[model samples]
Target: MILCVLVFVLSSTTLSQQHLSHPINFCSMASTCIHDGRGVCASSPDGCSRRSFLDQCDMYEYNCDYGTQFMTKVSNPCTDGQPDFLC
Candidate 1:
């Protein structure tokens, strides 16, 4: 019984470590793209102004061409419940 407990603890620790090793990228899960085709839903804070954002895409994303930029810009097709400059 003691050995079983030890094994379980070690296995659980290893599994958790693996999970922490691979942090989830909220960008990859963006329901909609933003800022034209030049931006991604990656984690970015400097480009966003919303003070209550909770997720990466909820506030900002990195613009490959423009460094950090708001998730959305004028003319983007994003709508409500999606990541945008007003998010």
Candidate 2:
């Protein structure tokens, strides 16, 4: 009985440690895609500012990284007046 209790305690501790070391990642479940060369212009949710991305996939990744909800703009807001640049 004592040996069984010891084995159960060790196994439970090992299982808990393994789970903590390898937490589940929900982001990896998102579909992967190849980014096209075409550029994408994304505008802030409030539309006060904008940024450019390498492509649509880049824009999506930026949103995911920042926990933002920026959407693609029809035109490049970065080029409307200021010199061509990326932000």
- Whole-model lDDT values for every prediction: 0.42, 0.63
Residues forming the 10-long window of minimal summed lDDT in candidate 1: 35-44
lDDT of 2 by residue, 1-87 (tens): 999999999889878653313332313422474767578787776776678877767776776677666567753434665422443
Off by over 4 Å in 1: 1-6, 13-15, 18-25, 29-50, 54-57, 60-87
Model 2 global lDDT (CA atoms, 0 to 1): 0.63
> Which residue pairs clash in candidate 2?
none
TM-score of each: 0.22, 0.51
Residue 86's lDDT within candidate 1 is 50
Output the number of the TM-score-best candidate.
Answer: 2
Clashes of each: 0, 0
